[model samples]
Structures are given as C-alpha cells and as structure tokens.
Target: MAPSLREGVSQARSFEFLRLGRQAPWLVLGLGLLLGPGAFPHRARAAPASGADPAALLEQGREAYEMLECPKAVASFRKVLAHPKATPAQRVEAYVGQAWCQVVEGNEALARETLQKALEIRPDYPVSPDLSPKLAAVLEAAQRDFRARAKVEIDLDVTARGAPPELGMRVRDPAGQVNEVLVRYRTDGEWREVAAHSEGASLWTARLEGAAAGTLPLYVETKNRYGFVSGREGTAESPVAVRVEPAAVSAALAPPAATGAASGTALTPLAWTAAGLAVATVGAGTFFGLKAKEEEARFNGDPSQFGSHDEALAVGRSAQRNATTATVLFVSAGVLAATSGLLFVVDGSHGPAGDAVEPGFAAAAMPLHGGGLFALAGRF
Candidate 1:
C-alpha cells in the first residue's frame, strides 16, 4: 500500500527530530528546553473546560456571583477547589464562594456549614461584609450558629510552670466535652500524650503528672454534642514550657464567662418576659416539628408497616399537615425572637451620647442574620 501524505509529514518531522538529536546535540537540548514543563504550563491541566488558572477561576466565580448566577459561580469555585494542589487559602476562598452560593440559594444552614469548614483551617478567619452586604449579613448569622455549636477557645492560667505542671484552662467550648492532654516529644522525635489529672469548674484544671521542665504541646479535641457526633483537633498556638521556677499564679473571686455568652447583658423585666415567650414558642415548635418528621420517616421507612395503601397516604397527609403547622410556628417564633434585638437597642446603654447605636448586645434570628461580625482581613 502507498503511504498517505499524513504519514509522509509524520516521517519527515521524525527524521528532522532524530537528525537534530544525534548530529546536533546542542540543538536537541535547546529544543527539549523549549518544550519542557514551563512551555506548556497551563496545557492539559485539571478542570480542562475552565481554561483558566485557579486564581482566574476564583475571579470567574466572583463575577458570576455579582451577576446573580449562583450555580455558575458555585461550579467555578468547585473547579478551583478540585485543583489537586490547592492551598489552604485557596480552599478557604473556594469555600467562602460556595457558602455565598448557598446563601443565594436560601440555604442558611448549609451556608453556615460551609463557613465552619473554612474557619477550621484559619480559626479566627473573618468574612468581608462589603463584598456583598446581603451575603455578609448571612455570614454574621452563620458565625453565631458556629459559635453556638462548635466554638473552641482555651485559656491557660500559666504557660511556664514547675516540673509537675498544673495547667489551669478556662475553656469557652461550644462543642461538647473539652478534653485536653499534655503531649511531649520523646528523644526519638515521637509525641506521646502524657497522663494528666483534670478538675472542672468555671475553669477546668489539667494537671500533668511528672512532666519534665520542657516544652509540650497542649492538644485539645472538640466534639459535637447535640445534633451529630463528630470531632476536630486543635493545638495551643503557644506551646507550654515548664520551667525550674513556676510562674506566679493569680487568683480572682469572679467566675469566668460561659461559652457563647461572654458578651451577654442582663435583660430588663419587660425584655425578660418577651424573651421567655419567644423561647417557649420556639421550643413548642421544635417539639411538634420533630414528632411530625418522625411520623413522615416511618411512613417512608418500610412497606410492611402499612396495613393499606390508602392508610399510608392518610398518614402521610397527616404528617404533612403537622409539618406545615410546625413551619408556621417556627416562623412566628423566629420573628418574635428576631425582633427582640430591638428591645436591646434601647436598653439604657447609650453610646457616646448621640452617635450611631452599637447596642451593647448582639442577637440573631435565623432569617435576620443582622448582628454578627464581618472582616475583610478574614479573606485569604
């Protein structure tokens, strides 16, 4: 068979490459250099269809968000996240973008979940309020939710202590059961958790037995208590250095503030009454909601549980009605509790005698998301 024109061109290119590689090694080296990693830096990268770098993908997401294309922006950010070598900062930015997408989709709970992942990477990470005032407003609500469920703060009474260290820790833990242990590095560079005795009060005491005069990492684990069971690990930013002479310990009569309530203010009598009603109403709503959901789940659970198809349908409709009532009650209670902040706005706490109101208190209802915090510096 006769060779085609394509084959002839391929053979010609191959012959030229071979002639250069053998007869002129320097030219071959030059050619290899020109065709190496740097020459096709962006070619055949992951997330091929995007045709943009991670930074560009992030920008595309931002522009899409501004244009109100929530799904497109989310997809772009997801592509950025899918990059195998994504940095923590890049991951955080992608998460924030994804969170904004959730907010746009009217899923505050999911949005809050997304932001929590970002905060896990950089604990004190803040969100920029000005980027999108509405979304930033959602972030404020999300942070409150985070603080309620999983905030972790550990305060030590002394960092430099004696041979046997008694580390007094005042933990503002929203996640359940704040567990701590002193971890020391062995001569072979392996960390072993040292046995420690602990006492609980407003301040929980963690006393390390026979711990030498050296630096040790104070490792803490936080667990989810109420809804789900999960955990995360955190380290003391500053390591503990046990010293020859223990540092002077200070004592105070006042008790430490509780987790998620450090900035609380005592309520007035009228405010107290309104707050009680709000709490009561929401509590009732939750009870009914859970009971109704249980019924719905059973109806959907197994076929044999039902006596008849019509009976199953009737049960389903009943559960639906119950759920509808729960929704109405939850909304009503949320409205009442949400507007309760207005009462605090005039709680006899004046700010600079005529400036803007700082409202010495902060509260958020699920829908309002009005009163938390936002920071541009929180951006990676």
Candidate 2:
C-alpha cells in the first residue's frame, strides 16, 4: 500500500533536492542580465547602453550651468568634448561652457586656459551673454593669446611681363610654422599649382611659365610643415582676377619673321653700304669716261697735227683703253646699285618700318662698248 500523505511528504523532503532547484533561478537571472534584453541566448552580451550623445551632453551642460551647478556643468561639457562624435561647433560650445564653470568657481587662471582651447577651435566665436563679466574678460584675453599663437597674414605681388607671370609673397606668420607657399592659378583651362621658393624668412616667389595672357584667376595658399594649409589670400572658388596685358601676348604669339622685322636693323645697314660703294664706282667711271672723251676729241681734230702716224695711233689706243676701263667700272656700279635697291625693297617690305625712301638711279652710255650703268641710293 502507498505511504500515507504526511509520511510521503516528509520522506520526499528528506531526499536531497535536485541541484538545479537552488541554482537554476540564480543561473537564469545571471544569464538574463548578461545577455541583456532581446539578446540571443547563445550569444551573450554586455549591457545594451551606448555612449552618451554629444549634442544631448552639450544641452545638459548648458542647463547645469544655468542652474549654477558649475561642477556638474563642467562634467557634462568635458564628456561632450571627449566624445568622438562631437562636431567642431559642439566642441567649441563645450569649451566655452567648461570655461564659464571654471570662472564661476573663481579659478580665473584655469578659466582663461579653457577659453583658450575654445578660441583655438574658433577665434571668432562671440562671448555669450550668459557668461559672467569676468569670464568675458578672460575670453577676450584668451582670444588675444590664440591670435598671438596662430596669426597668419599673406601679402601677394603678381607681376605679368611679356614672358610669364611671376608671383611673390610675403607671409607674416608670427608662429614661424609655415614651411611653404603655393601659387594657384589658371588661364583658360583648369586650375594649376606652382610651389613657391623661399627667398628669405617670410618671402617667397613662384614663376608660372605656361600661364597665358588673359584674365588670370589666382590665389595664394600658405602651408605648414606637413602640408596643412595655414593661410589663404583667396579661395579657389573665388580667386583674385588679374588682367594680363594684350601687348605682351601679341609679342609672344608673333612669328620669327615678325620678330626680325620688328627690329629691322639687319638688312638696312647692308643696303646703305652697298649704295655707298655703288656711288664711288660710278664717280670713278665718270672721271675715266671724261678723260677718254677729251683724248678722242683731240685725236680726231687733227691727224696731221700728230708728230707721226704711230703717235696718233698711240693716242687713239690710249683713248680706247680708257673707254674700256670706264665701261667695266660702269657695269660694276650698275650691278651694285641694283643689288642695293633690291635689298632696300626687301627690308622695307618685311620691316616694321612701313616706308622706304625711293633710291635715285643714274645711267651713262659710252661710245662703242656702250652699256648704260645705273646707281641707286635709298634710305631704308
């Protein structure tokens, strides 16, 4: 027969309880806590909470400051700054809040230091009216300190001559951290960059070789040692407009022939020299021709007036020789004169000088061996 109910209960209680009975509840609780809500049973997890939002922290900090809880405000602001997700504006706001907290606690030195951090983030950030007058004073002093540390000034000089455009810059960087300056420019095409060479402390120059003559859009960028842009005169989007002279452009585009003509010195001198030579030859020819004519006239006037036939023959021969000599000189003069005139025409046609003076020509015919000689002279 089955044991009676009281006896059975007592006996069952005496049998040791299953090990799970005491530990299972605690085990489940431990698992639930470790896995967190909605976590898979097989994939245990830590707590589900994420990092505090930077924007929320910033707001909370502002509220804490308004309530005059300087320590809590500073704690919230510091958390916002330490968060990686914080934006530049949020960072600046946090620094300002923390600085104001320091000022309220009578920690003026620390307050100025904190304000300096905010100014480094944004030098132009206005002092908030919520800040105490003392804090505002600290902020101003912090700004002055930041400016002293990071001030950058750029002075640019652009010179466009007939060749290429040259750019010079004087950078007043009190921090002495600027390592280089770059000249950014463009003509009709895309923007280009040329590295500037340092001439001395704060002085730099760059020559843009292929920059054409037109409206050159340009800007100067100063860089630090690691190539971080430290300063800018103008941005690439809104560059400084510089007008390049058209005269220089024209000269650059001119052809070699055009270049020679512009000077116009080469052929003009040669033409003049040829003309002078021709004049001398012609004068000599004329003198010989006159002597020949005079001798011939005397010989023809009286044959019997000669002492003998041989004497008359000699006189005639002498006249003929003179005539021949005159003819040869005349021919040479004519050739030289023609060459001079041709040279002058060539020079005037090609030269930058528009007009040339017309050369004069003279010709004389001889008795028998007669070819007229001509000489020409002209100003080129």
Residue ranges of candidate 1 with Cα displaced over 4 Å:
1-52, 129-132, 158-160, 163-380
Per-residue lDDT of candidate 1, residues 1-380 (tens digit): 98899999999999998987687756544533332212111223334234567777876776676555778989988988898767767777788878867776778789878988766554445654334455666667767776666666555543423334555445565645345433332223444555334565535555455455545554543333221213233444554433322332211111222333222244445566677788888888898899899989988889789999998998899889889888988888877776676665554343333333332332211110223322121101
Q: Which candidate is the best by lDDT?
A: 2
Q: If scored against the real structure, what TM-score would every candidate get? A: 0.33, 0.38
lDDT of 2 by residue, 103-124 (tens): 6677878978887776655555
Task: State each model's CA lDDT, in order.
Answer: 0.58, 0.70
After superposing candidate 2, which stretches have Cα over 4 Å from the reference? 1-51, 127-133, 158-166, 174-380
Candidate 1 has which clashing residue pairs, if any? Answer: none
